[model samples]
Target: MAKKDKSEKKKKSAKLKDAEREARLEISGDLGTAITQASRSLRTVQTRLLTRSGLYSGQEGVVLLLAAEEGLTPGLLAQRLGVKAPTMTRTIGRMEAQGFVERRGSDADGRQTKVYLTETGRATVDRISSANKALERQATQGLSGKEIKVLMKLLAVVEDNLHAQMPAELPEPIDESEDLAAE
Candidate 1:
């Protein structure tokens, strides 16, 4: 009878271990979902603020870059922004249509097109800078400086872990110009 009791005890322990593992996995999934939702919410707020400055979500980065240094080629701009060349080309085209930027062929390299900010682009970049400051302040409203720093560190760690598992080469980004035309 004692041997039988010991066997039952072992079974219970195994089941407890399995339950604990399942709970941990569920918590991890919940954390991932929460992070994704938070990112989406922040982007929504940024888009609204950027619209007030006569810019779109991704255009502010371009304007900010050009404001710091004029006459950057699309390839260099795309590399700096970590986007594909075609994507940058489309973005530059839109900014050109908006009268915020102009593209000129490089005198040194005929094949290379360099982007320059118009006067309107310069003023918009200033407004974008101010809006960014306001957005950051609003996002961290109740958090202390130390708390914000800790939060940033934790996020960086999470990003590093994901990057470690990512493939060396990601698939090429698709050009969305055709989709835009269809719309």
Candidate 2:
């Protein structure tokens, strides 16, 4: 079974390499490559810190958002996060089970459920926020103030482009089989 898994991974890597080479040739300093690599590196560190402290990469953002706004509907949270309702549903399910959040029917709309952070979530999120600030400081140790501002602006542009290009908030697709297998 392990050998098969290894072979499958090797095949996938080879395919990605071919695609990357093709992309690199077509676009000098491919924006996608740089964006993907940087995103992966950040996610790795973020995930490590979050997982170590019993959280997930995007989950902390949810907690923080809820912390700031106590009665955000799930739909509102999804809108804020640029995720689909179902995706928010699943993530909130995990969070709710973990005692990081509580869901209640919206006062305005019985059909809508609101997400609220719990006391435990507040403490957990505060720790994660401190950890994130530390990581950001370490990552930007040598950058000048101007450079940091420029980088932030550039990232904002990228984010805006993505949302502008796609109006629908699609749920981030998951390889459910892999997720279930992990469980």
Candidate 3:
């Protein structure tokens, strides 16, 4: 009975070691390790800045996108951000409450809502953008110019691959008629 107990203990110990080995192997690969590490590091920086600035991640991106686009619908903002409509709607609502954005009924289509950044939102985006640039420079201290370029290209490829794998509808080219009509 003692021998049998020892044998079972040995098997259990071996299985535990094997599990640990597999976990290590899974994260040892370059793609997995780099992605995990980069996400962790980026989140740390983002959270720090966000905490200090009293902003949320998705909300800040929305502000910057709105700053550039001037007047975009929540549908268009969701498409640009690659998020779902409900998610963008909630974020925009929060921003609206914070006095960062305002929504108005579109003259072209009263049923459709158009989002515009308030002066407060534009100013916040500008401030956050400058802070983000400084934080990014500090984050990429050791990388060379070529390394930075390659890193961006590789990340873009990874993003494209992930989006290519998704089953969602892709964006279409803008209609010239729509642009002229808007003008």
Q: Which candidate has the top score in lDDT? A: 1
* TM-score (all chains, Cα) for each model: 0.71, 0.70, 0.70
- Rank the models by lDDT, top first: 1, 2, 3
For every model in order, what is the number of clashing pairs?
Answer: 0, 0, 0
Query: What local lDDT score does residue 101 receive in model 2, on the 0 to 100 scale?
Result: 92
What's model 2's overall lDDT?
0.85
Q: Which residues of candidate 2, in runs, are more than 4 Å off?
A: 1-29, 166-183
Q: For residues 85-162, what per-residue lDDT tens digits would candidate 2 score against the true structure?
A: 999999999999998999988888899778888887888867888879977886676589899999999999988887
Best by TM-score: 1
Report how far residue 9 has shifted in candidate 2, in Å: 40
lDDT of 1 at 173: 83
Specify the poorest-scoring 10-residue window by lDDT in model 1. 21-30
Tens digits of lDDT, candidate 1, 1-183: 999999999999879978986776677577787688668878888999999877888999999899999999999999999899999999999999998999999999999889999999998977887888888898887589999999999999999998688777997987889889989
lDDT of 2 at 116: 88
Per-residue CA lDDT of candidate 3, range 1-183, in tens?
999999999999979978985786677766768688777878778767865666777677888888888779999999999899999999999889988899999989999999999988877876787768877897777589899999999999988888687756877866879889998
- For model 2 the local lDDT of residue 145 reads 89
| Residue 42 Cα positional deviation in candidate 3, in Å, after optimal superposition | 0.7
Q: For candidate 1, what's the RMSD?
A: 16.2
